[model samples]
Target: MSKGKFSSGVDLPLPVNAPGVTKQERAYQAIRDAILNGLLQASDRLPSTRVLSQRWGIARGTVESVFERLQLEGYITRKVGSGSLVSAVIPDSYLKAVTDTRTGEPDRNESVEIEETPVRQEGRYRAQVGVPFVARLASPLLIAPAEWAAHLQRAMAAMKPEQMCDVEPQGAWVLRDQIAQYLRKHRGIDCRAEQLLITNGIRHSIDLVARCVLKPGDDVCVEDPGYPAVHRIFEKAGANLLYAPIDNEGIDLHGISDSAECRLAYVTPAHQSPLGVIMSATRRLELLDWAQRQNAWIIEDDYDSEFNYQSAPLPALKSIDSMKRVVYCGSFNQALFSNLRLGYILAPPELHHRILALWHTIGRSVGVSEQLGLAEFMRGPAFLRHLRRSRQEYQTLRDIVLDTLMAEAPGRYRISGEHAGFHLILWLSPDQDEDALVREAERLGLMLQPLRNSCREIDLPPAFVLGFAALTRAQARNSARQLARLLH
Candidate 1:
């Protein structure tokens, strides 16, 4: 058909001469790559052997042999008169998942397969409407599906054959270039594409850094009531997790110093999880200074810096890190849909290749189509427009939660972390039993995440992190009343 090229989808290219590889082998490889890369989509019609051989300038016999191999491998189905069609069930679902060389296990598709994805007028993710979310987090409206689909279409259509064959482990250079620009503009971080590494998400970024640096029994510092998963990631890498209690300014510097042995620290300075306090500029400087002096790296998880409702959000900790001690981590999952699983790490120039080397050693990568599509999306003005709409919508939701809860039960509890993020902390009196409240809430058909879950050693007043991003007006009010009643 001679379809135009794209990263999300494209036409196969003719095989070029190789010193040792046979013409048959090269032809086979090209078709197989097309199938794997979604350049030949599920159930798409394939060109007739005669047409392909003539078009690609390959020998008729070699083209026929290639087709035979593809058919035998179930990559295509041949019907005598109907011509050949691509398999209805392709091995790779839009995104190619290669077998991990180390584990010998094929990676699972992270994105859900859509038989027919419908784009609503409001551009909501239809699949997430009633789906049970992981991590007790909620996503706001951050993407225009119709526009996103169009961008993806363009992304696929624009891919050249060479791109499918040569994938970068550090990430697609175009995507990294966009990210470098995005960070500089949005987060005030000054970095080049060379310093950026695209990851599956923040956890993946952290895991890679941990693997690259940590040895068995090495000490890693974290905010006491920080992201629980970060704690586990550090622990999984055989490092002893040390807790640095978070205060009003941010993770306590004094608490961090208690672990003179620690060389790595993870902080959520943008909006600390559960507690929701922006790390003060002074504290940011202090943390950066500490990391520089101690020769340690600070993992600054930039959570919810995009959705600040009060004032313009502060610049990211990484922006202030003149010492290059902060390794900035963030993801599109919270901003986009959860399954996007696309994130980035802006490491210091010195740490970039070490992290890249670890990424290379792992030999796992997010599919080329998603990367190219995302890069295309970010390259346009559409992303900022979508982000603005999302921020406005989430602000309205945040107001609803604040108003409903305040009117229903004044002074019953104090809310923290409400200035930013999809979730906020409902802090009850210290005497209140947080665990019992959580259990009672679940019994009442509501999920309440206990603050203790994020904390390792810091003892605090009873509190629960309340997620409200996806709640409708009615749901917000009803849930507020339900939670207010529980306090009684």
Candidate 2:
């Protein structure tokens, strides 16, 4: 029989005595280890401090201190009605360590089945439309600032032998601080270093958030004709998917209201994915209010926000989130080179610990060397100069493409999403099927993505996405001409 008496509702193990560790530290470590080892799964309610104190023969303050520490570390979460519960952030290292400890001398399979791979038919025509000009692009891959290179070299040289092996699962503090500052100044999203989770790219950030917030069978709402990659992520996570309609003013929030099943929604309000429509300020507020009312989470993927040409980019959803219902995500892949693979998420203060734990579990932290280099780049004078130059260059190329297409194919297509990002949308006439047009364009040596490709099976349109960022003015003009010739 246990020595402690607990309230009838409170169920917990009697805390064991620690030989050398303090009671609070012992309790903290025990709970943390339980969570890391999967002994305490997500949503598992924790015992009250009073019960724990009674069980351990320690003061209630010590147990309270333990709970506070665990909460701070993101290993546990506290809600108004629900006491402390084990967080959903699974430490990947703990799982790996567990697997290594298991009896692993498995019997080898005698025969492995070989599957036949499907062969792709060769296309006769290949043009430089809607595709990155990787082959024709200049050397060194990306034209990173000289200061970035210098900082990277310095970081590498300064790394000690053991430091080299240290896996910075939370990313470099210097870079995280710089990113927080940059977001505040440029995007109007004020965030602390602790609230920012550095990731390899937008996709990784999306994956981490999904893993932490969603369980299998949970429904997630995404914009119709939204980012295809996000759809893939949700599907891979076994989420029940829902779609909100999109229009010139951005996502049709009314549709979201009609669906009561979804607890999560993904919106690209700065520039709607594939469509290029910006959500109006009124709509943005409405959406936020709706999210708060429903106790739903909104993931704001502000991709390609830096290249706004028509007007200053509107403040991100995160910037105005008083309820802390929005998770703002962004990437530098579009602004810089796609290969850079750097992105970040600004989570709510409540989610900071869980997200960090998720980061540690997934081992998905951005490279420390690259993070330091990026920090230096953003801090140095060269980064702003590069942004200004790239903005001008992309704007010029965008204009050339739009001009050529409008002049040559006037009534054939309607342009959208030219205000920001490297990509634009060309809405084809109802008479032309988008996939057929794409196939025809390919036959004429042009590679184009059908806008319908970004949509779900039931929702599609006769349109295509054209990226102009990586292309030169001449290339844009030529690609536009080729597209016109193919369509007309």
lDDT per model vs. reference = 0.71, 0.67
Return the lDDT, model 2, position 5.
23
For model 2, how does the per-residue alpha-carbon lDDT over 391-441 read when each residue is reduced to its tens digit?
778788878888887888888888777877767887778877667767777
Tens-digit per-residue lDDT, 1-488, candidate 1: 23322233224675677665577766766876566444666567777788778867778888887776566434676888887776634332123222242245432211222211111211222234422111234454446678778988999999999888976667788898898888876676777876677899888899999998889998888887887767888999999887888887677878555447778989888788768887754455556657656778888888567887764455677764545577889898777777787999887756766777777776756888888999999998877777787778777867787787788778788888887887788889656677787788777766776777777789887777777776666766677777777776
Error of 2 at 294 (Å): 2.0
Indicate the residue-level lDDT of 277 in model 2: 82
List ranges where model 2 is wrong by over 4 Å: 1-148, 158-168, 257-259, 431-436, 457-461
TM-score of each: 0.71, 0.69
Q: How good is model 2 by TM-score? A: 0.69
Query: Worst lDDT window (10 residues) for model 1?
Result: 114-123
- Candidate 2 overall lDDT versus native: 0.67
Error of 2 at 5 (Å): 67
Instruction: Give the top-scoring candidate (TM-score).
Output: 1
